[model samples]
Target: MESVKAQSYDVHIDELAQAALNQHIAKNDYSKTFVLVDTNTKKYCLPAFEKKFEEPIDSIFEIEPGEENKNIQTCLQVWEQLSNFDGDRKSLLINLGGGVLTDLGGFVASTFKRGIDFINIPTTLLSMVDASIGGKTGVDLGSLKNQIGVINQPQMVLIFPEFLKTLDPRQIKSGYAEMLKHGLIKDKEYWDDLRRENIFEVASSIQKSIAIKNDVVMQDPTEKGLRKILNFGHTLGHAIESYCLENYDKKTLLHGEAIAIGMIMEGFLSHKLTGLSKLCLNEIKETFLQHFEKVDFDTNDMDAILKLLKYDKKNSHGNINFVLLQSIGVALTDIKVPENLFEEAFSYYKE
Candidate 1:
């Protein structure tokens, strides 16, 4: 239940998190208060949110759930609602849900009336550990993931792990993937410790992942350098997510599910390009396969996923940038990957 301070915000956990939120609401003079959620959160999380939130809320806005609803169109709906409710620069937006709602709500608040005050109470494990903590607020452009957004910090973030009880096992494992990513990138002990536990029994341990991510974000708020390392598996993970999303023939991947594949593929790149030891590489691949089902990617899927990589946010001067591992818990950034090796990376994952 300890609080971690970020560059401009504090992440408060569990019971005391509500106290911190009450303190924030008591001190700030918000003209009007709004809460944003998707249909899922509205059904499962809103009651708890209202019970803990002592102040009067001006409005509640609900959007459809899922990755597809995370777009400019959803933002437009929320913005229109805010305008209709007379939300002003002094208004406060409370984002209560998983990554999709929080991401879109933050973007809406950041751009509404030239930005308004907002805070995140991430309801899902994925957002609790990673998405809600980082100031990286944005939404998808078409089927491409997070292609439009801004680095706008929230007033604060409150994590009540109890909200995670509302999640299905698949969603829980989805968030667990990001937690594992944290250990892989920055804490080897964390990685080993996580692999031993039941993914459902590790809610108390999310603070470590949040702290790890916050430490990195503090050092590189705009991703100028060190922050890029946080994206270790995301480059191709996002591409895979986008491809699956647009290809109706395939099942859409949850963020962590796609990254689970991305991590294995990028771990292969690390072995090939960054000198990760063969033992370590096998350990990485084995660990993920133990928890995640290997996705079936044929020649067509691989070709389309590779084509989608050009649009990765990290690319510069026609180079696809990646964060590769020097070893577990250590990362290297901005590495240019060769096109020929892309298929081999997938092959490594398959093996």
Candidate 2:
């Protein structure tokens, strides 16, 4: 497979990914090389990475896995470790894990010494398709997702689809939701194709998802305009995700799981506010519900989630903005949704 070019780097897939990483390591002379993994990836992915790269890493840093751990405390720990190990501006950080690991690792490398080189070899399906492709890297601010971070590109994104084999069924299903969002916002045919596809046997769809996300990032790296479209379900999805992560009473929702609900709810908003047809709205909600188990939110859950909306990065002038579909393959960005519709959207999701 050919490498997909980003604004500053290339995203290499499958066969091309290994060569890209090996060549990149061979070519760079770094002060130190460190591999960052969460607990799960450290066990499942590190051996494969070592065998493939065949390079002696100066150090390996591991964090606990899950969305809750994506925070300042984790970043601080990694920073101290890096500082103790004498990581300088010339050091290279190889992030080899899922979204939480990659997200936190990228932020740590970007800020150490005012920025250092980092490579993302995303291990799980979610990271493979979305998290590792874009230059956007950050950790959560308490219950808020990505409230603290930077817009720094990786040296290159290396994706090995075989890494998906390390994941359980639930994780793969979680990643698939992001791919569906890609279809809902940009390519309806791709969405239609995904409905019939199997996650256990995968490769082409992973690359296609990468291409969709990379295309958006390349055009608007800073997210001044076009890039906001990538946040299709994220506006409400992130709030719902954060709510679940911190509340022990609620089951912790995976990033995609929360976004699945968000997509359905936002699809409701799109139909009511953006001229999306009723048929398409039902299609969007039903499509997501097929793969993801629906969470029944009580009134309290809705109240907390709505309060969380103000913290969304997309909001401007005290108004929450959304990326809503005009139709299956087209999207509008920076859309301000009325407060009155929030309950209706949630009610629509419940129905």
Candidate 3:
């Protein structure tokens, strides 16, 4: 099996597409195995997944796709199905899809009957890089993101870039944001290299993105120090995502798109607070503008977005702390910024 080593994790790359079933059957020799996929992923990638596993799969569970379906209700439904099938702690769950499937499936398997071994077959770039490595599994709670979850590592993370060929362009971009964030926080060379490449070409870019994430996760697996770098653009980015999902009628911004904007705004914040060079900040803004569609924010909308920031999971004692840049490759965490600055920073995108 082809594998890339991460700090505390071993990420099996595209090699798994050809070996997942046989490898598992020989290794675990479990009486039964379950494969989970959402409607879209089942239609798109399930055939190859089935072909790999010559042995009979205990069952296949298909859930409806979309962010709305990722929740407790869906988890309960999956649990009911497992119970009906006599699934036990010995059963293994192979989660095959994007971030939603991996995140939700990991959570279900971890909590089902106290816990069961689970493997991630990440078909989307986002899951391959971020979700698959972190051991963070959960579902959104109401307007909040990842409010209910656990930190249980998967037995193995199987990533197949071939599956990305079936992803929508927007889905591809959603994953690209995390890759970009990885560069922005810790690796300037990675940032420059990725900037020159076409993100849609998943095969070429997967290893680098995975390597960067692995290095970061290894430094702080429990999310204490270096791990905060991953949140560089997520502070305001998440607030924008939540606000757009809850109140807007226009095209809802995906996680990546929101972070693209967050990185720009945070670039501005970094410049103001740390004297991050104007040359670097402008380069960051222009790069995002080149790849992502500019999101227009009205004055009233900005107010709502700012209000949502206070609800961020990273807040401490009600203070709005953010991860801002010291330079392209350096990051500083927990910098408190006043509410008034949000209006000024947001105005940068109003054009």
Candidate 4:
């Protein structure tokens, strides 16, 4: 098993139903074992988990799958289930799904009975590399992203590459965006490698990305400092995502798609504000556009997205702070971004 010890827990990467989970289960004394799954994971991933884990699952909780269902109401339902099943502080909750399931399950476990032990088994590539490793857990509060979440660690995380096979093409592509972001913020060579056609040849790249994130989290787990680099494409990306999800005319954008556009916009802003080279900006734009379709944001869409950015969790005292790239691997954090730049960013994205 390839293990990366992160901020508060260890992430074990190996084939599912192997030795790691069985050994870990033997070591813990939990009152009950609960596996939490979404509608999709229950149908797809649960069987694999059951075959791998020899221990009996005392209970299973299923929630609706998707960003729309990630709300307080779903959390309330989970809480009620845990309560009805007599879950206690010692009880274990194993979250088996993608980012949505892991986020909701971790939040529920952290808040239920003043926090219980939970394990994350992220089924999607996005969750495996980003969501499962970070220990950042929360459901979206309406259109705002991660506005209500606790920075609580999971008991352990299990990542099996086999899960990626079951994912839709778009889901696979969504997770790839995060891996691309990791390279953008930390290693230029890593980014270049990701762009290569034969990039999948390096199976180690997935674990390497997880390691990169783990290194960042170990330094700043609470987003108080260096951890902000992880939000390189997330600031405006999240605002755009929230805007599209809430708006009547626009279709809801996948997290990666929104962030891919965010990266392009931020790359332009980096050139205009942080002195990131024009060459680098164009390269960023081209690379993202190759993988993600350009989002058509008109004047009104831009206005709505900018308004939603005001409620971003990264903002402090009404000032919108952005994490911009100074170079491929160098980042500038907490830059006070003017609202006018947002209009220009929309123009750049449109072009």
Candidate 5:
């Protein structure tokens, strides 16, 4: 028996399919097993994955891949399909895709029959570093992100880096933003390492990122205290993400791209309130700007973006709270900024 790390429910890294299946079956001898995949995973990664399973899967459910498809309607559709297969509490679900699929599949399994077991085999870097490990599961409602959800841990998580071979460059960049956030909030050494390393070389550092997130999550799995560090760039990043998602007709921003911008804006806020050095702030902006495309917004758009920030989940008592920095390695949460300061922060970005 291998020693499974206890940070999450149970995590098996670089494990083969047969070993993963054996471990799962030993835990729960179920009558049926369902493998779930989004369209992209099914087309590219599933065949190789099928070769590793010794037992025939009871069924495979494939949904179209994209953030747009992650919602209640998809969950209902998947539930209807599960019903056709008589999926019950005794059954198991294997989610094989990125965050969208893992999020939706976790929600479906947790809700179906009042909570069934599910395992996450995340194929994308984003899901591997952020979504797959956290017990938080949910589907987006309307314009607000992850508005409806629950926190339910998966039975186990299986990570195989081979799956990333086919991921697009944009997806890779999107996932890297979360990794950078982990470093910024908790480990300055990790942050420096990330800045020095080449982006294409991230696969070599996956375990390091995973360990950081795993440790942070275990410290406060319920998302209190140190866990708030995970939201370092997300406070403003999420508002920017929602703004682009709702108002834009073109390609919506990826989670990492939005956060990259958010990190910059928050860096500005950090300087204003926390005495973060101007030199560090400029470094933060330069790093992200080199890799990500910057979006230009007029004064009116900036006002709308600020309006969206008021609804951020981190807010309390109707005041817009922020996670700003005291220094490069330090972050302060629940910092309230006056509405006038919002315009000043955005103005800092104007060329």
Candidate 6:
């Protein structure tokens, strides 16, 4: 397995990163090892992980899939399972799944006995480039995304493009949004390349995206400063995700799906508030819409989503701050956006 060393953790990218996992597990000498998975991952990914792991995991804990299930109740279930199985502080957890599983499992392990060793084997593209890095362990609180969690680094992260083969095209495209965000925030050449090339065909592109995030995270681990830039599009994206999940009439947007829309709306805001060029803004919208299907929203739904922004974790002094783009490859964080522009941003997305 090829490894990319990041500041917080080393990401081993290969055929499920088997060699790295074997080396780490052998070296650590933990009391026990537990593997966590979701239903989808269990059916599609676990066998591959098991084959690569070679050793016996003490127990396998499987949870239901989907954003809706990432909550306090699910955490309780995992905790109970760990307790019933005699898992202790010295036990190591191997989280083998997509973002939901990694986030939930990481949070569970971080809080289990005040922190146990854990490694992430991210199976989805979104997890590979974003969630599996950064050391942000979390679970959703009700309709909100990642509302309750901690900042704890995993022992290591294993990334393998082979797992992406299990995903449907939409799932794969959903992960592409984060990759696009990486390019837009840091490298214009990367952004242009993503626009011009087939992302699925390029392995280096994934590494480059992961590297960009790793660089930013290394500079600011606590999200106290530069790290906030990583929240680009996430503020509105999360609100939309929450609102859609809570509103039965509205279709539930996947994390990347909601964020794709958020990027478009935020792109319009970027053009208006941060001097981002119209050409760049148009390009962003065109590229994203080309990849994602349009989701329907009425004026009321938009208003509700906007209102939910005040509860955003990034807000301070009752003002909803946004991470806007100064240019295609440059981002400005902690910019306070006016209320009226919310509608205008929505209008731009509509057109």
Give the top-scoring candidate (TM-score): 1
Alpha-carbon lDDT of model 4? 0.87
Q: lDDT tens digits, residues 159-187, model 6?
A: 87888889887777878899899988888
Model 4 over residues 240-340: C-alpha lDDT tens digits?
A: 99999888789888888889999999998899999899999999999888888877878788878888988998888999889999999888899887778
Sort every candidate by lDDT, greatest first: 1, 2, 6, 4, 3, 5
Pairs in clash, predicted candidate 3: none
Worst 10 residues of 1 by lDDT: 311-320
- Per-candidate count of clashing residue pairs (backbone under 3 Å): 0, 0, 0, 1, 0, 0
Colliding residue pairs in candidate 2: none
Weakest 10 consecutive residues, lDDT, candidate 3? 13-22
- Error (Å) of candidate 2 at residue 313 is 1.8
Error of 5 at 318 (Å): 1.5
TM-score of each: 0.98, 0.97, 0.95, 0.97, 0.94, 0.97
Off by over 4 Å in 6: none
Candidate 3 residue lDDT tens string, 1-351: 357775455677666545744676687867568899998888999998887667788899989876677888999988888888889878888899988889999999999999998888898878888887878899888777788999898888877788888988988988888888888888899899888888777567777777777787877888887778789889899899888888747467878889999999999999988667989999899888888988878878888888888888878799998899999988998788877788779887654
Off by over 4 Å in 4: 198-203
Number of the top lDDT candidate: 1
Off by over 4 Å in 5: 1-8, 16-18
What local lDDT score does residue 1 receive in model 4, on the 0 to 100 scale? 48
Model 3: runs farther than 4 Å from truth? none
| Candidate lDDT (C-alpha), each | 0.91, 0.89, 0.83, 0.87, 0.82, 0.88
- Model 2's TM-score against the true structure: 0.97
Which tens-of-lDDT digit does each residue in 36-143 have in candidate 5? 998899988889788876667999998988778889999998898888998988999999999889999999999998999998888998898888676878888876
Q: Clashing pairs in model 1? A: none
